[model samples]
Target: MNRETLVNALLILGLLAAPFAADAMGEPFYVTLATRIAILALAATGLNIALGLGGLVSFGHAAFFGIGGYAAGILATHAFNAEPLLFGLPGTNQMVSIWLAAVAAAGMAALLIGLISLRTSGVYFIMITLAFAQMIYYFAISWPAYGGEDGLSIYVRNAFPGTNTMRPMSFFLIAAGLLLAGLAFFALLRNSRFGAALQAGRQNEIRLAAVGIAPFRIRLVAFVLSAMMTGVAGALFADLNRFVSPSMLSWHMSGELIVLIILGGVGRLAGPLAGAIVYVLFEFALGGVTEHWQLFLGLVLLCVVLFARGGVVGLLAGRARHG
Candidate 1:
């Protein structure tokens, strides 16, 4: 196998193994930590489709992330209370149904956001996307139905068919399995005709336009797909923590997703996973030792930007080989 493939395999296996090993050692905390890595990595993978593949640096992705979280929280809350939704629709504690709702809600929001944001480029695009995110963030804060700024909480994990999601390993497996599926989609999308068009537009919009391909359309579709992926992660995250809040919509969360991509190796299929691993481990290990842990995290990020521009996967597997 190629080095990149091997490295990718190792990364996936390492992630799956960490929690199992932790469970063996009676370290449920570490297993939970691994789940966080998986969910966050999946979110970043979504961002990578826009930022890395389509070359659209979106700063408001957290908007979709939060929307997905709220989808889960709101649905579960209604189900628990046995209340009907706005349309007299019954709330569901089913994970499958919740995921579909999250995807549909986030995708619709993305369609709206993309229609507006894709009109601008460079700094304007960045600012407008960030503006959209902040608008949602404030709306969440002011909207009292779901606990306003205090956030919404799910008293119990949602049901996932036959699996007992309350079990740490079961939940981790669910997250990890979704992450694997996301990665597979990434691979397939990257090698597809649509992916070629997206990347080509990123490289040269005028050329793509001359070839009768619309960059705007390609990007809008990609942006929507990206949002859907991240939205699923948000659902899983809410389930993981049993809580959803306005905090998920914060600009900081968006930036964290970007950092994960940069740390893992932007555009590389396994980059997000690698980035999430390092980022979470750093946070977990350093947070316990120092109050100013962010200072060190910043330093590490600086090093990555300055010295290892290709990121962790780049360092281990060398530059990615595009075929």
Candidate 2:
């Protein structure tokens, strides 16, 4: 196998072994840490679809991410209290239902946002997306129906079929499975004809259009898919934290998503995954060392932006030789 293949294999094996290793070592905290990294990586992977593949630098993905968290929170809350949703639909705590809701909500939101945002490019595109996310963030804060700024708690994590999800290791496996499926989709998309067109548009929109391809349509499709994936991650994040709040939709959250992509190595398949691991590790480590951990994170990010272009993957693998 080539270097990339070997790296992918090692990554998969490491993630698979992490929970068992932690359990055997009597260090449940590291298991939880690994789980958080996987989930964050999954979310960053979604952003990578648009930014890395399609070259659409969206600063509003946290809008969809928050939407997914809210979906899980709302349903779980009603189900916990034996309440019914609008139209008399009984609320459910089932994981499948939450996933569906997360995808649909994000897709619809993306459809609407993409329609308008596709008209612009460069700085306008970035600012427009950021504005939209901020709008959602403020809406969440102002609207008090589902606890609004206060947020809502999931007293019990929503259920999955045939598994004791409450167990950290068991839930970690479920998250790992979802992440692998997402990675498969990413690989498939990157190899498809449409992916080729999207990348072409990213590199040169005029040239792509000269070849009879519409950049707007391709990007919009990519944007929607990216949002859907981020939304799925948001749902998992809500379960992990046992709460959902407007903070998830904030502009800062969107910035962090972008930071993860850039920090890992833009356009590389493993960029976001590696970045998330580093980011979570930094957060965990820095939090233990200082109360103002974010200050240190900002400094580290500044250093990365100035000195390191390829992030951890770039540092480890050198330049990518493959297309």
Candidate 3:
């Protein structure tokens, strides 16, 4: 095990240990906090696929995240009310069903968004994505069926096969498991042929095209896959809060996801997890200290950007070697 591997392993172990330790000490709130870190990390991991590998600076990922949240909220609402979703498709309280719905909905949205946004590059791409996200955000706010601006509430947590998801520990384990799976997927993707092509396009699109590779399709697929992953995280988040609102679709949420990736280590496999841990801890500790905690947070982010370009993981693991 090299330094990077060791650090990554320690980070995951620490995340797992912290929650269990908190639960053992009867500090359920901390378990919830750890779960938030895992969910946010999962969302950031999705963004990392596009941003890190494909070099796509998508500023509208919140659209997918919100879509997933709404999927959960709407599905749970229909199930609670014993109503059928469109076309006689009954609402489901099952976590598997809700996750499938979330992934499908978000994937479709990503397809449309990627088809249009992928045509542009650089700042144009970023702005186009952001614009699309804002459109959805406004739509969510104006649509009153599911509480609109106030957001929709789920009366009960979604059922996850045999597991007592109502228990904080159980839910944390589920979220943690997903996070681990996501990390593993990310690592595999990074080493696969598709990952190679994506990174090649990121480095030199002209060269990739010369080799008969289509950068556009590769990027679009990456974007859609990224959206699907983030969407799943959104479903988990809604279950954690038992609420879904337009706020989930806001640009701020998108920005925060990017921040999580950057803070952890932009292209590093464990970047999202590292960043989420630091971010959540900062939020918890600073909020308790002062209401104007954002000011301090901004300063810390500035330092990371200027001095710790590699993020927390980068700082610990050394700069990654590019081929």
Candidate 4:
């Protein structure tokens, strides 16, 4: 394998090994840290599909992320209380079921948001998406049914078939598996005909339209799919913290997802994972030194944007060799 592929493999293996080693060394908190990286990477991967591939710089992805968290929280709450959800549907603490609900809820929200937001482009699109996210964030805060600003808490972690998710290692593995799956999906999409069309639309929508491709439809589908993936991450995230809140839907969360993608390598398949690793490391290492560590973080991000245009992955992998 070439350097890029080797680096990618090593990154995944390192992530896997680090947690196991941490667990063996009696540092379960590190395992949780690794799990957070996996979940955040997965969420950023979803954003990459739209921002990296389709050139859709959506600024409201937190809406979907929050939706996923709420889906898990609401479902688990009802299950814990032995209550039925809307339409007489019973609640479940099953991870599989909760994931499905998260996907569906986020997908529907993306569809509605995209239907209107996609009608515009450039700054308009960005602002519209951000507006939608803010609306959802406010609604979540005002909605008193689910604890409002205080957020909803899950007393126990959700169950996964054939696995004791309560164990940090087990949960980390689950998150890792999903992260790998998302990476694989991203790679496949980046190479497929649809992927080509999506990129072409990004480069020149008029040309793609001349070739009989509907950029609108392609982007809309991509947006919904992206939301679904991020939603799954949100569900996993809620389970990780055993809580759900409006904070998940905030514009800041959306911006962070975009920052992860950019920091990793905007269009690179493994960018999200790489970025998450760097981001979490920065947060952990810097937070211990100063409370205003974000100022330093911002400086680092500025350096990345100004000099390391391709992100950490791009820098390590070198520029893509085009024939």
Listed in order, each prediction's TM-score against the native is: 0.99, 0.96, 0.99, 0.98
**Model 3 misplaced regions, further than 4 Å:** none
Question: Cα deviation in Å at residue 34, candidate 1?
Answer: 0.4
Clashing pairs in 2: none
Residue range 1-323, candidate 1, lDDT tens digits: 88899999999999999999999999999999999999999999999999999999999999999999999999999999999998899999999999999999999999999999999999999999999999999999999999999999999999998889999999999999999999999999999999999999888999999999989999999999999999999999999999999999999999999999999999999999999999999999998999788788888889999999889999999987666
Tell me how far the alpha carbon of residue 52 in candidate 1 is from the true structure, in angstroms, after superposition.
0.8
Compared with the true structure, what per-residue lDDT tens digits does model 2 show for residues 60-155? 999999999999999998899998988898888998899999999999999999999989999999999999999999999988989989998999
Runs of candidate 1 with Cα error greater than 4 angstroms are none
Check candidate 3 and list the clashing pairs. Answer: none
RMSD of each: 0.8, 1.4, 0.8, 1.0
- Candidate 4, residues 16-117, lDDT tens digits: the string is 999999999999999999999999999999999999899999999999999999999999999999999999999999999999999999999999999999
User: Which sequence of candidate numbers ranks them by lDDT, best first?
Assistant: 1, 3, 4, 2
lDDT of each: 0.95, 0.88, 0.95, 0.94
What's the lDDT for candidate 2? 0.88
